[model samples]
Target: MTARSSSAHVAEVEGVRVDTRHWIGGRRVASDATFTDVSPIDEQSIADVHAGGQAEVDAAVTAAREAFGTWAAMPVKQRADILRAVADGVDARRDDLAMVETRDNGSLLRSHLRGVMPRVAMNFRYFADLAEQISHPIDEIRGHRQRVSYDPAGVVAVITPWNAPLMLATWRIGPALAAGNTVVLKPPEWAPLTASLLADIANDAGLPAGVFNVVQGSGARAGAPLTRHPGINRLSFTGSVPTAGVIAEAAAKNIVPLSFELGGKSALLVLDDADLDLAVTLAVEQFDNAGQVCLGAFRVLVHESLHDEFLQRVLASASALVQGDPRDEATDVSALVSRPHFERVRGFVERALADGARAVLGGGPNDDLGGLYFRPTILVDARPGSEILTEEVFGPVLTVQTFATEEEGIALANDTRFGLAATLVTGDPERAERVSARLNAGTVWVNCFFVRDLGAPFGGNGKSGIGREGGAWSFDFYCDVKNTVFAPHGWHAVEGGGDS
Candidate 1:
């Protein structure tokens, strides 16, 4: 229940000791086995978390299943009020939560406090208001009066990734709760601190026991069981594609619906008519979280006319970014989540160089700052078909490629298997509209990058993901739609009663 200030360099959170346990039903629960949580910033032990396996998953799912009816049956106004309180609770403890997340995931404290923390509360508020405004519409068809209603999808297994842990978790949890489904969240072991804190906040907000639960551990030990559990009616996962496939297979066994927000090798197309300054600004912004974001512009497809100019601008921006301790407010790029991930990202750059791609700026790790730090790299002259251009390198690396014509640019943008998100920078509104339609991505940004509206749908197409997760789309995903038909009493079927 405690965290260090943003200025502290050590991983120690004051009151949170070793043996941090799971939050099941309404209270803390422990397991025999435990795993150590190491800080990405310093590679120091943060805490020893109870490693919840199938036994813990069973307890959490059972609790959620038991609580579903009561939570679903609660008055809409009451649910809205509870959600509002949860939002307020997050706002009240914003600094602490942000510090915990910074320690857990090595994200910049400035970004966490200024960008992420506010969105955490905003997400809850959005769903809270939506709960009150939601309505069931009626329709008349073929002489039958039909009313369509939405019901909770029962117990939902919310599995979140390490990067942007709480924000992404809330993306599913908020809508799922607002839709009246009980949630058993399984946060990534690497970054479970903030999520655990969130559960505590929800409890303080008077969220009933068993209505929300949190199980902490790795994917195989905790996530697999949660996904395979037959008691779970739906699964919402935001992580890598391979892990998502495993979850999808397990959910399929139980015929449970799933919403997968998987990885992305998204493209940012800089058209010939683009504003060079704005394009470069957006490109740097895409790499804000050290390029750990799912919607990051991994592949930069610039029109041949502006390719050289764009590369020059981007290189300057990437090189000027400060890389140091995440605790420091001035640090622009922090460490990767772990040493393994650091090596993986380093390997991507090395392999690209070995395969004949040239480095425009940084080419490898930054041992100067210590910890799992990688210099923000820009790989140029990368072939379109190469792994560097096609795969999801979740790091501060940008691959630049050129296209001759508009047709070629669009084609190159959609060349990859991932269709999560794409950005187009152009001055012409007509060209923006025309190219956006052909991009083949779930969300397309025009003239800007990462511009999001909570009311709009947010998800991917193709291998990027399966379903949407925002606004009405999120509510629909977490709820089951049922059609009720009403028949008139003593109604004889008159000839042509319904004007077919």
Candidate 2:
């Protein structure tokens, strides 16, 4: 066990690195079966977890359903209070959780995404404020008083991806709790330990028994049953297109309300008028989180005039990223979440190479890395249907292509079946605005890339996802809308109030 900084509020961190179980009905319980936690560094078992299944999912669902009445009936302020407590607890134990996240997820080269905590903390707090600000409608019918109010949606099932365990959880957890709903969380099996630890944080924060429950298991056995559970009122899912497609199908059986944050093959347009140096920096940074980020600018479209220079600058920037142990503060790029992810990304590169996509810079895995470390690859001249151009290579890989005009750049950027996010670097404000409007992605950054302020509404457009995940609009995703009109104590008005 390693000691943490003052914020963690603990003397030492537990390094036993054992597998995690589940949190059902407010307690840690083990499933009948278990699964191994494979280390990205050596492809060996570092830890294991209760091999969760339909039973565990059923238990979590039962717990949530049992508490849904009281939880949904609780005042919004009280629910907000519980959320605030969770945020405070997360902050209190930030460093320990960060370490565990790094250990479990094989953060590229392995960096605990704890850097995202400050924003996550803000997410919980912002949702708390938004809770108090939930709009209630007041209407006057025939000059008389009438009112409408919001209501809860019972149990919410939040299924988050391994790429960002805590941050994505916070996004859903904060709003669902604030909106007066009980939650059953199913973290990705790839990063179950950290998610279970987060459940512990909620328990310590004094969330009521069964108000928040966590289940650990695979999507097929656990996630499928959970989403299809009749008890679950809404499902907030973040993951891949194929998985999302499956979850959506199961959810449709019950006609459950769904909030999906899926994949993105986004683009970054480097305009000829942009600052070349800044453009280079933004390109690599935009693709931070090893391009695993759904919002990352994976595809780069540079104006033809600046293509050569921009390519050179971006290559140097990508080359400079220090990839190694995520725990090492000096490291910028870490290993992907697992060896499978490494292979998945490498396969994309290999397919590109097989095609005419030229290996402009890096192109494959770094054999020197004992762990799963891949060199930042850059491919140029990829054709329309190339793997590097169409699919998400969620690794330290970049693909570069040239566009003759701003229109062409925009066209190429939006040409994909995906529309998650895009960034434009241009000195001309008018040009940036014009391009931003034309790009089909949900988020468009001008002169900046992948930087977030926490308050912004974050989600995708088109295939990326449905509905927003942040800002005031977040309440709508978690809380169901009900219009209730109560008129004054008189039955004078008829259906046709015009009085023919």
Candidate 3:
């Protein structure tokens, strides 16, 4: 594989050169073992990342545990102010972070600049304010006043995925920090650079020592120790289901509460009355980020009457997508995050074709743009129970399924074991409401896709994994709720426990 120039591989954020070592106790901590971090764009060695093991995990957890009490006890206003500062820091270094993330994960640079980078700041700002404003009403019943309060759940272990690392990490980290729990984050080894940069941003924003830490390494060496560590009070993970099951088993032994946002094989349902243009746009949009998104509508279920037109439009749009370097402003698609992922996605298409599926658009790699650039694929006539149709490929591939009736369409959309999100297209308001309700998904987008509000609940169901995290839902998972019951002022206790 070709490699990018050495000069281009070096990254700097906020005039401070990016460091690949683990960040513990507000300083860079190096592990004895190390691994070469590679970029997917040209499969080039970007940096030497410290491959943290059990010792590093223990140190990070200890730092977080030591910092927890002071952080949790701090006034909400003070914490909120610190978070607001962190948000500002992120915004100031937006360009650097966006570029680094693009290099590390092969996502379009424009995407990071326009949508993702800005959202990372918003996650912190929104959660900071929300945490400060959190309130629970008190009730007086049977001469007793009852009130509930939220307390930080000690040290939280946050494990984030690579596709949208910083944004998703803050999605959980913002709330965890706002709610006063210190965090030990294990960023995906494939894209760990930006996370290392984020630690600097947090420290510069006046976050106390040991409040936020990063452990860099692969799943087995760093992730396993962090997730299973007894010092961790809460475990939050966003990744594959198989990994979640392993983390869950580890969490169970220590009785640590878990918040998981796992994999999905979500469906996009287009009714006969739907606007064909809008439906096609949404379907093709799934190819964004090279279809590495968990909420992507990979299984597109179209009404039989409009399936042909929808597929034709999708092919036209997908064919026009530019597959090249993600750093290029005009590039619409880029390489898969790694070589293994590239082969895995290619295998899905190859097996589907061999199983009698017909490729409507693309079915293999784009040789001209080689390295790991796979052409956007659209497969039809796929075997019903084939892995290509049922599994989470996490690639730029879509399988078209036709249904004759609205009932059938809904049935097909809900057929998956994963139900993270669903997209419903219909001209009728009533139909959108009814059909969306019937779709077995945690979040149902009507007409529009990827429209996210930080306040809205976001997560998955079934094999998509468990828990909702956004707004109050995030605090609910990161904090432990405590209810207190006491007698009202000057009130006499009733032996019968009934109001007089």
Q: Candidates' TM-scores?
A: 0.95, 0.93, 0.96
Pairs clashing within candidate 3: none
Q: Residue 141 lDDT in model 2?
A: 69
Clashing pairs in 2: 19-48, 33-51, 34-51, 107-110, 108-334, 108-335, 109-334, 109-335, 110-326
For residue 99, model 1's alpha carbon misses the true position, in angstroms, by 0.4
Per-residue lDDT tens digits for candidate 1, residues 1-500, read 23533322123463432226789999889889888788888788777778899999999999999999999999988998999999999999988888888888989888888889899998889998998898898888775777988898899999998899999999888889998999999999888888878988999999999999999999999999999999999899998899888888889999999898888999989999999999898888866778899999878888998987788888887778899888898898988998889989999999999999999887888869766888888888876588998889999998888999999999999998999999999999999899999999999988877878889998899899998888888888899988887776578764345445
Best by TM-score: 3
Where does model 3 exceed 4 Å of error? 1-16, 490-500
Q: Put the candidates in TM-score order, highest first.
A: 3, 1, 2
- lDDT accuracy of residue 218 in candidate 3: 96
Top candidate on lDDT is: 3
Worst 10 residues of 1 by lDDT: 1-10
CA lDDT of each prediction against the hidden true structure: 0.87, 0.78, 0.90
Off by over 4 Å in 1: 1-19, 489-500
lDDT tens digits, residue span 1-500, model 3: 33333333234422336777889998889878887777889888667778999999999999998998899999999999999999999999999899889888999999999999899999999999999788976987675778989989999999999999999999989999999999999999999989998998999999999999999999999999998999999999999988999999999999999989898999999999999999999998999999999999999999999988888888888889998998899999899999989999999899999999999887999889788899999999998889888899999999999999999998889988999999999999999888888999999999999899999998898999788989899988999998887776776754454544
lDDT of 2 by residue, 53-101 (tens): 7888889899988988888888878878888888898788776677766
Q: In candidate 2, where is summed lDDT lowest over 10 consecutive residues?
A: 4-13
Better of 2 and 3 by TM-score: 3
